[model samples]
Target chain A: MVNTVDPSGPKPRRALSARNIMLYGTLMVVSMYYLLPLYVMVVTSLKGMPEIRLGNVFSPPLEITTAAWTKAWSEACTGINCDGLSRGFWNSVQILIPSVILSIGVASVNGYALSHWKFKGSETFFTILIIGAFIPYQTMLYPIVILLREIGLMGSLWGLVLVHTVFGMPILTLLFRNYFASIPEELFKAARVDGARFWGIYFQIMLPMALPIFVVAIILQVTGIWNDFLFGVIYTKPETYPMTVQLNNIVNSVQGIKEYNVNMAATLLTGLVPLVIYFASGKLFVRGIAAGAVKG
Target chain B: MTSQSTAKRPVQLLRNLSAKIASIPMILTALVVFVGGTAWTVVHSFTSSRLLPKLNFVGFDQYERLWSTRRWLISIENLAIYGICSLILTLLIGFTLAALLDRKIRFEGAFRTIFLYPFALSFVVTGLAWQWILNPDFGVQGVVRGMGWESFAFDPLNNSEIVIFGILIAGIWQGSGLIMCIMLAGLRGIDEDIWKAARVDGIGTVKTYVRIIIPMMRPVFITALVLIASGIIKIYDLVVAQTNGGPGISSEVPAKYVIEYMFRAQNLGQGFAASTMMLVSVIVILVPWAYLEFGGRKRG
Candidate 1:
């Protein structure tokens, strides 16, 4: 398959090499492996129930319909309400914006302090937060619920936001701290010599320098907060459910004949935000990961 | 100089006060949120609470009962398997992809983006997609059979023993991107002289990767393992989204079990008891490693 000899001419023929053939073959298979689910999702989403019943999942249905898409968006019964996941879409956005901004803002501040100031017990603070990131949220769930209930915010959007912020602190702090640590310490020292206040140093000196990493933090926090399900489900009341909760209800209903088509569409719709982020800032994330934000 | 000194006085005072007060909020947050919540859970676990958290102390009975529950026992076992398998698979695949991409390949960004995109999508979505892809009659099975390869099959989701592996496969897809990014970063950070030295010594690429490159990336490996380990412990979304603990509760994990007992089963005590066990186990495994890594004195 590789290095086929030329018959007429003195020149060597650049035949299809074995490595090329193997690479192309493997890449095609792997790409298909990645694409299979999306392909099936698209297929099912476009097909009517009659086509779905025909059991040709890989084939385009002879009679295709956008009915499933419309139904999933507007009329599919997710719970007691027949209205689809679109009902909670705004609630998701509201929760996401505040949670992402607060968590990132606080974390960047914490990172600046921990990395630059090196105050007493700052290391301890970082350690506890890192460890907290490992504890299963279920372990903290009962207590958080109790605390929120006692404070009368148990089933409120504010409760959910607070919970997200608290949980987000550990990873975000760790990320920012690690990043800020790698930056030249002279920047902070210079700002200090100029009599920059702590806030002044952070705002005037560190903030401008941290623009790229801040973008990374924004991407991470947005994707995470947007896709979150447990906090949204457990903390927020039904009226303020996120789209994940709605998708969960629709697809994960215990008593129904599960509709694959609607489930796929709903899940895709729920993930659209994170997927957009992935496509948009994916390279930045790669480079950001290289930043060694949590190597310790 | 006098004017400067006078200006510095208020600034110095504020700095001192700020540092003094800096920890106050963090400690308060940790106390009220982490410590207070943990204590509350511990107390509730000892109580005979149900649905709305009744506060009558029952003492170790819930823990005793949780220990005896087959599902709880299975969850612990499942987590161990899932954790180890997911970590290994993610590390292996991620390292390979990272290494491949680091070869200065053409269109490197495209390949890296392809691999990393999966991490952005939530488990709820990826799980659903995987569910359809693995559906015995309608998915990969159907596609292969339609191509006249009727002997092909991937029914792990339906089989209990294999279901964990199924979950592991899906997890690797979603998580390996993170590992890849970490490993790639670590690889790229290597000193250029090492590669030059290897080349001068006439070392092949395979030998170089195994002997030289792998050892140097230990920090990133450590970071990747930590991230993956945490993910393994808290892996509820994917299993719930994909399998729903189905094939007769065969794929049940601790988190899901805790959620079920807490909410649907209306047994908050049992849920907290299971949670306490998970916490203890995590600390047992992680605390020592953490101390060695974070607290121990550095080697020469």
Candidate 2:
């Protein structure tokens, strides 16, 4: 982003010069490629079914309609349930709030301990935990199912919340671990020298200073748990399916008429939360994901 | 090992008790779920554990059955094709976009926001959008035909032969931006002096990139490769939302096969074997990278 000058480069010229044209031209084409689906989804969602069948997905609607949006929000059915995606939306909210809070709370504490406390064999456990992140969730899914069944939380939203917390721990812990480790060791020593124990330092000093990373972790988990289809489908019954799972079922269910307009509307609705988070917390979202690429 | 492991002292055991108490969730997750669970599955895969994972050791039967199944083979082939193509194209496209945006051009932020927005959407949303776009009647093919390109066929989603590629198109759109952001960070990390020296040598921009910049950014490339490779092995929701492994199960992948057998078909042993194979593929991809990244380093 820094405009470091290249002394040997072409002279500064008008905006419509040959080089500028080529550069902007390529960028514009690529931009369109990225934006086209969103454009199509919105355009298709706004048109009625008959008009959509006329076969111009790129055109603006002649007569716009809000019927598809309402239908997708309330009237579209999945199986015996004729109620639309609002149920799934609320279910996701139920899953999202607790999962995000519990995961970040546990992970932030774990990160603080690993960086500052350094107990026996802590690194071994930490290494195993980090390596666990790369393990395919399919391998671990059944065992966790059995774990949930034993506790009688199977097919419940809280069970899915626990599942999200355990799976999310590795990355969130690492995100906070690498962050807390970079803090000067002197800060911890100073706090300890003042006779402050673990809880006092963590609650007073670490919590306030760690606000930004908390935002990043929240963004990561909110978008992740909301967009999760696998855990939602596997852990919860139809009554508690998350938005993504229900969206897929509604759009892909074989029994229904293929209502493309309603399907697009539902798809857009499913995607709205994450898209909003990504746009609103633009650079922090980038930082959160980029943290994954950073090695221990 | 810390002093407590060797000393076995009571004080060391009680030292930082709150920290250790807090780490119980983490320790249980690492030891019980990740390690113990994987071992349990691998062990059970050898048993005749059907319908409810009741173990009655039947060594290699599940493996034999899995290898001989037609669906499993197609899934492997589909994964191999998808993985290779996705890797090459993502790195190429990701790096190229990074390079373009690094040009200090106008509206770089706007360009990046556009390119990366799809990464924010779930695969379910992405798949359905593309599914509608690839609809044979009212989608790109129809639009193209209506625009006078008669006889032009482009319906990959419904066609069993190329359904995977149809999924691949949606996959790249949703994922490449993350790699782009990573590669841009790597490009930024390169000293500006490198570019100055390349320009001084009169080397072209593309040449300088291939010969100098890319080779220098090997670590970043590896990180991105590992991220993409791990992501590629778990391509379930996208396929489910897109084709549902349709056209007579021609588009099925290993994850879907595992899910189908274990959850739906009541064949736990088969799903166990299929999932174990997935775990193996992931380990094969991960171990070498972990060694290269962390094995040699010493903890302070």
Candidate 3:
């Protein structure tokens, strides 16, 4: 193989050049830095208290165990409830499913209307919505509470679902509107000429064609509502606390002996939903974030 | 005559009614929640509302009290420190990583996946993981001490003076990857011919990036800056998770202050005042940027 090489051809260099070494070296260090906490979390979760206390956090467990994960999932205490993250996990699922569906459904229709069936004063409201995205949630927090209380939905899961829909409207609407606007006008016009009304055309032409954007929207909304601590805390009671709020309580609760293993396991459990979505829909997640960022 | 004219007007109004009906949610949100809610908060900030909202109209008293409060002052100061440092460090680290990744390196996807995974997790998870990793007894300090540097002291969660920096480290860890992705996108958008031309002219890569590429990526940088800045202003969960504003309230932030006063303290007026201040701060940052971004576009 070496003899077959032409002398005039580019010379094959050694595998680790100085430039290559530096590039790879820097990347490796940063990657290690990024990976270190996850490693610590996994390792700490696997070790017993004796092992955790005896060794530094970075060490692999001499004795492997799933006790902490089990405790975190089923038996760890958060306040009076001895039930672990499973309660919070189910609560998150309840909130996640509805919030995702309603927000995407409303945003898609809003986007379709804005892009295709523009009426007087629509653009003005759209502008206001986009600008309102930058407004801090604090500005509306108390008022929303009062509004929800007035409607007798305060401290309920439905209230949170409504809040998520209101908040998610701006970004999701922008996503769908931009996506719909990018579709060639002729397709919309063709549907119109064939006597398709607004709902009919939307259901037939737009929904199927915009499935990718729907995926992007779903990814965005699921991660967002799942990871939400502020709304979950403010809108829900102790019985309905989402996974993030419950996880924080379990880890940070002052009354108990600090179970570092259980805390790490709980943390991992709370993060699993979005992590799974992220790893599974890798490029789509990137696309979703990119779409969210560009308009901001 | 009036009835017939009114009937004709209703018919005209019914034109494109489906679009209008579809937009009711956006309209209600924009007008009722956003505009009306902000107005309500600002108005009530002037009142002496205790538990429930009341319009007792005590002009600027809440504001005065808020400014003079020690925790509020500390919170503002921490926000300033955290905001400035997080902004600079995230951009620097993010851009550097992006540049490294942009260099046609091996294992780009693996490296990116590693970096961005933390971002997928919530601030709560990030905070907890870092809190454990930074714990004094069983964490970095202990590890180093075991390695024979017994005097090494690096516990930001406990030290009041440097607690914000501890949070800052975690913040950067979770956030810089995102900035890297955005920066990489900006880098990819640069024309290949620009690099070719620069290479043909014997301009070094570093010099070209510093002198040319950065300036070309101005909009991308601005977008990233706005995103980071907004996030910094609303930084509550991370603090709640990591420090809970402990080390005697050294890591307290504005959002936490607002929430506590509104709910815990049962002082709606105070929360209103604090939230109004947050609104003002956001306006201070947003208006000029918006003007430059949208207004200048219109004028041009």
Best by DockQ: 2
- Each model's TM-score for chain A is 0.88, 0.95, 0.95
Report the candidate with higher lDDT, 1 versus 2: 2
Number of backbone collisions per candidate: 0, 0, 0
Please tell me what DockQ candidate 1 reaches: 0.38
In model 2, residue pairs whose N, Cα or C atoms come closer than 3 Å (at least 3 residues apart or on different chains), thus clashing, are none
Please identify model 3 stretches exceeding 4 Å from their true place.
Answer: A1-14, A294-296, B1-15
How is the predicted docking of candidate 1 categorized under the CAPRI scheme?
Answer: acceptable
Model 2 scores what on Cα lDDT?
0.90
User: Could you tell which candidate, 2 or 3, scores higher by TM-score?
Assistant: 2
Better of 1 and 3 by lDDT: 3
Q: How far is candidate 1 from the true structure (C-alpha RMSD, Å)?
A: 5.0
CAPRI category for model 3: medium
lDDT of 1 by residue, B1-300 (tens): 011244557666777466546545455556666677777787788999888788899889999999899998888888888988887888888888787777555567777777777777788888888877788887767778878988987788998878887887788778787787788878989987797677667777679889999998776787777677767777888988889887788888998998999978999999989888777866776766677666767521
Clashing pairs in 1: none
Residue range B1-300, candidate 2, lDDT tens digits: 323346655544555697899899999999999999998889999989888988799999999999999999999999999999999999999999999999879899999999999998999999999999899888888889998999999999878899899999999999999999999999999999898898777787889999999999999999999999999999999999989988788889999999999899999999999999999998898889878877879644
What TM-score did chain B of candidate 1 earn? 0.88
Q: Tell me the deviation in Å of residue A212 in model 1.
A: 2.3
Alpha-carbon shift of residue A132 in model 2 (angstroms): 0.4
